[model samples]
Target: MEYADSKCNAYDTYASEAKLYPCLPPVVVPSAPELIRVEGSAQSYRLQKINEIQKEIATERDKHANLSKKYHRAVRIVAGVDNALVVSSMVLDATGIGVLSTIIAVAIATEGAAFG
Candidate 1:
């Protein structure tokens, strides 16, 4: 029988034995303590990364909360101003002063200028 050696060349083994058993090269394995140390280091690294990510998430949540508050406040202010405008417009229309027509003409002119 013939088998490939470490150099990958096939050689006959039948002269010494009728049967040949395939064997693999010996492998060097780490000791238990070495393996534990490596695993511990990896676990610590992962935990550290997790903590950093959690902090970043917290920061972003705070930013989002602040932005949401500001947005709501602006919406409320705009709504109040719109209500005031409606009341004023009604008062002007009821007074028979021709101010509403003037305001409408000005608004139309401003709109045309802005859009064009």
Candidate 2:
């Protein structure tokens, strides 16, 4: 009982609690409130909003397709004009990176490539 503080401190703090009576957990009962949401076709409204978003996405897709077509056409024209450049820098010299770089550069330069 009268052990030195250093020797007693070496044992775990919970040893006292373990020797004593165990603590009991309190029971909890959750109350359910009257979940009445003032709904007059809320799902329809959400659907309408979703449809609008889808339409916007479709419009964006169309714009992207058109822009891609125009970009492809421009790249084709640029490549044709600079066929010698492409040839000298690419396949003829066994380097495809130059051709890919030209395509990317043309798209970036013309598109302004700045999202914004």
Candidate 3:
């Protein structure tokens, strides 16, 4: 506009240029807290470790209960077999001495094997 002779055009160009200039001051962003952030990260890690131990304990309890059930089942089978042997012994009492003796020997062998 320096070369222009008209005052009106020069004023319009100056007005437009002034509008491009910044009116408000620059913004200042706040800095983050370094020590506090570090502490918070450590605390979260500790909580995660504690939670993992609790999960392990719950799993162990379930394993123990399952093992107990299997042990009881084996005990029941042993008891049933022992009872059958006792009933058979009673019925064989009047048989020939030789046969009765053989049954008794077999029963003793079976009981010893089962008890072991």
Candidate 4:
């Protein structure tokens, strides 16, 4: 009888504990995914602006490089033409024959025209 009473008492205790600690609805805390999504949106917006600024900087650099190259090329061309003219004049002074001078002058004129 005592054994049966003990078994019954154990079952009753378990049942009372289950009833006392009934399952409750979970607290409605914001999910980690929701918080992460909000942060991600803000970060993406900042990154996009940074990327746009970087692109603009790259374009400006390219334009500057192109202009520099063009300027250098123009300087080189002018220097070469000036040197050629000086050499031609020296040669003409050295060779004082009339026919040869005429031919050389004509050639120089044509070269000048082509280069200029």
Candidate 5:
């Protein structure tokens, strides 16, 4: 009985001297409603930015289309003028007039200067 009592007392003394470590507190979290509101606002902002980008792309596409149309029209006009020059030169050569060669040379030089 005396030995058992001594052993029990020693255990109690060791238990009292034991060191305890502190634990970190749990992290705080937002409620469901608050989370929903934050997410909704973020989503709306993203959507608005996407729409702005889309509008910019559409505007650029329209500008490109207009430029393409102007370029094609200019090419057609140049082609028609070139054809007219060829026909006039042919008619002058076929006539074989005395001053026709000089006139043809002047016409060709003028066309070259204007185009080049």
Candidate 6:
């Protein structure tokens, strides 16, 4: 009974010491070459992503430029049509006035000849 009691006391002391000072497992560190390889892969992935973004940016810029050119061309065509319509209206007005004036002159000459 005394021997069993001593063994129990020793276990209790060990448990108390373990609680006060905990022992953590050893940390496994990676080798230098393994760390370098991992870093290189990460850098390559980032560069690839950057290149893809740049390509997207260039594509968008091309689309924008094309749209701008089309818009300018449409504006120029509309302006030309408007100018042509204005000129045609002026020509029609002049022709109508010329016809009316000739008829009036003929009527006045006939009236003077009949009176004389």
lDDT of each: 0.80, 0.75, 0.79, 0.79, 0.79, 0.81
Cα lDDT of model 4 by residue, 1-116, tens digit: 23454433323345434343234557899756545345887999999999999999999999999999999999999999999999998888777677788999999999999999
Task: Report, for all candidates in order, the number of backbone clashes.
Answer: 0, 0, 0, 0, 0, 0
lDDT of prediction 1? 0.80
TM-score of predicted model 1? 0.51
| lDDT preference between candidates 1 and 6, better one | 6
Ranking by TM-score: 6, 1, 5, 3, 2, 4
* TM-score of decoy 6: 0.56
TM-score of each: 0.51, 0.44, 0.47, 0.43, 0.49, 0.56
Candidate 4 wrong stretches, greater than 4 Å:
1-39, 96-116
TM-score of 3: 0.47
lDDT of 2 by residue, 1-116 (tens): 33365332333456553333233457798899887875769978998999999999999999999999999999999989798786677665555677778999988887785652
CA displacement after TM-score superposition, residue 81 of candidate 6 (Å): 1.6
Q: After superposition, how far is residue 84 of candidate 4 from its true place, in Å?
A: 0.7
> On residues 22-86, what C-alpha lDDT tens digit does candidate 5 reach at each position?
23458899767544345888989999999999999999999999999999999999999999999
TM match of model 2 to true structure: 0.44
The TM-score obtained by model 4 is 0.43
lDDT (10s digit) by residue, model 1, range 1-116: 34454343234455564324434578899867544345888989999999999999999999999999999999999999999999999987787557777798899999999999
How well is each residue in 13-101 modelled by candidate 3, as lDDT tens digits?
56544434344569899998676455877999999999999999999999999999999999999999999999888767646677978
For lDDT, the strongest prediction is 6
lDDT preference between candidates 2 and 4, better one: 4
Regions of model 3 farther than 4 Å from truth: 1-38, 94-116
What's the lDDT for candidate 5? 0.79
Q: Lowest summed lDDT over 10 consecutive residues: which window, candidate 3?
A: 3-12
